[model samples]
Target: MLYKKKYSSWLHRINPALKLVLLMGGIIAVLFIHNVNVMIPLVAALAGMLLIGSGQPIGRVLLFMLPFLFVFVSTGSSMILFGKGETLWWQWGPAVISRESFYRGVHIGLRALSFGLIGLLFALTTRPVLLFYSLMQQFRLPPRYAYGFMASLRLLPLILEEFKTLQKAYKVRGVDSVKGWKGWWQKLRLYAIPLLAQSIRRAQRIAVAMEARRFNKSIQRTYYYRPGFSSEDGLMVICWVGIFAGAWIVGVQWPLFEITDVRFNE
Candidate 1:
């Protein structure tokens, strides 16, 4: 809900397409890292960047990430609860706990969190319309596909507002709210039909508008927003690379965990 069309952040100055590429490269780099010490500090550094680079309230970012707890927990718990190891700490029919598994579990959890933060960083700083625009201008993406995606993005808010309006209309007509799953299904059907019709009509109008505007893949067109590369992009690269290098150096010199490679077997 903390949607902003403009921010004075240094990160916002970087091109959206470049930001996506850097984030993808960072994720690939993270996958090769098996050291928990490196990942731990790297995660901390990313959180710090969210505070410094994003120029948004860190509290808002933290609030957005609250639900990710379930994701990382589920990700790490699987390895901890069932992985095989030499030193057995606990055993049941199928579930096993061991020293190696504990290390692996911690590693998996941190890795998942690392991936989540990468995605969060991109979503927090980048605007969807700008991203798609960059795709069209910089990446040479077809105009039809790019503009279609932009139109769909615009539709989301309209759908939500229409849904609220429908709810109020029903309430005024003395329609009671439902409690259980059956009642929920009925309510869903009630809204779904009208919403589907409205969406179809809106889509038809959008298609007509696009045709009038000549959004052809082969046709050359001008864009209102032109996201170009700049010095801020270079600075962002420097900052990210520095954080990753520093964390790796710290881990190698002073590792808190003895097991460096979670995959190695004795």
Candidate 2:
């Protein structure tokens, strides 16, 4: 399920504009936070919120996060091996490990996890239509762009279904035996050509329909659904501010670990 509706979740109840603000704010804060201790807890909190708002089982959420974990590990390992630092821990011909580099690597990995969890939370709980409506209503976004975006999202499932049908048809016609790298390339070309043509035809038809309805004729329009700020949005903002403040305070005062960025200048 790409975008499941969770009517009962608190995240769902909050306005989309507020959620968008939280998402962007969290990401920006995470970027400047270099301490692993602070990042780890932030990541955990975001993950917990995501799980709660997703209304999905813990097992499923963990399963969904496996790929992100893999990426985190890969990036961390690379940073640890290549990053430079003053306190040397291990050395080889070309690869060196240092205490600072190791900690930096861990921080990078935790940062990735924190960022990914924040994004996942937004993507899982928010609906495209709601976001569109909220943008147009609260932010005064142009209706033409908002409706076009909404239309594209609506067409996504159709495109996926068309691809699946094409795959099945090919299999039935005994042309699905392709394997290996070369065969994968061949299969991609085969699928890509038809999908491109289908998408173009669909886009043309949608454009005609929209134009017929005078979608772009006016900048002012009435919306059936209007989104507004609520108490929940206020609470969400407060909670996010507290989380960010607490993380920074603890990181600065307690000093579980220090974040050092080495820079050289002429």
Candidate 3:
């Protein structure tokens, strides 16, 4: 469900490890930004990148972000309704709406939106297999865990299929359906035992296969996919730096919203 069919996006060319590091830095930087004016431009930059980098149409990308938008609204609205401020716009028993709170709410919303854009940018660009493989190659990650994780991802579909088959079998065999919590517990026991047994058997088989194939953590080995940095990496770095630089310049100079520091009202 999460997989993207297209691999031609420019973002795919960037090294996963480098891309991840840069992305983490960007997210951390975003957390420090408290100004709505700053966050607005930043979010715009991210949205632009998403549209351009993902090679997706504006409509499609916006459609993808609908859920995140809902999250932004919920979080921002909560802050606006409940946040404390001296300048009151509306008052209720527990809820208070003020100019400061509204600004803060917008700031929070923009932050959330920026996060969604960043996450989607990474997801849309990075392939799961490539990500794991890149981690193993670039970071010298212990092969035991890497290959195990890859194997598990590959087996997930089969495991799910088996679970469904087992469920159907239980129904065919006239398993009694109890009511309420007991039914839930009974279902758990009935389904869990067989699946656990199968999973253990599968694990044992995989272990044997790996040992037979001489897979181990020791000794250097060549990789089928070698993730390396390129001009594109530099370009990505420049773009990231450019976005923040532009955001800070525009936000400070123009000053879109009233509140500058969202952490505290001044």
Which one wins on lDDT? 1
Model 3 regions lying over 4 Å from their true place:
176-193
- lDDT string for model 2 (1-266, tens) is 44665334777777887789788988987877766767766776777777776676678778788888987998798778888777899998778888877888888888888888877778777877888889888887777788887887788898899999999998888885557998989988879999889988998899889989987654668778888878988888887887778777766667666553322112
Output the lDDT of residue 15, model 1.
92
Residue pairs with colliding backbones in model 2 are: none
What TM-score would every model get versus the actual structure? 0.87, 0.87, 0.90
* lDDT string, candidate 1, 1-266, tens digits: 34476655888878998898899999999999998889999988887887677777778778877877778898889899888688889888898988889888988998888888888888878888888899888888898888887887789899999999999999899888778998889898889999989998998899889979787554567889989988888998899899899999998999998888888476
For model 1, state the Cα shift of residue 142 in Å: 1.1
Which is the winner by lDDT between candidate 2 and candidate 3?
3
Please state the error at residue 230 of candidate 2 in Å. 0.9
Between candidates 2 and 3, name the one with more favorable TM-score. 3
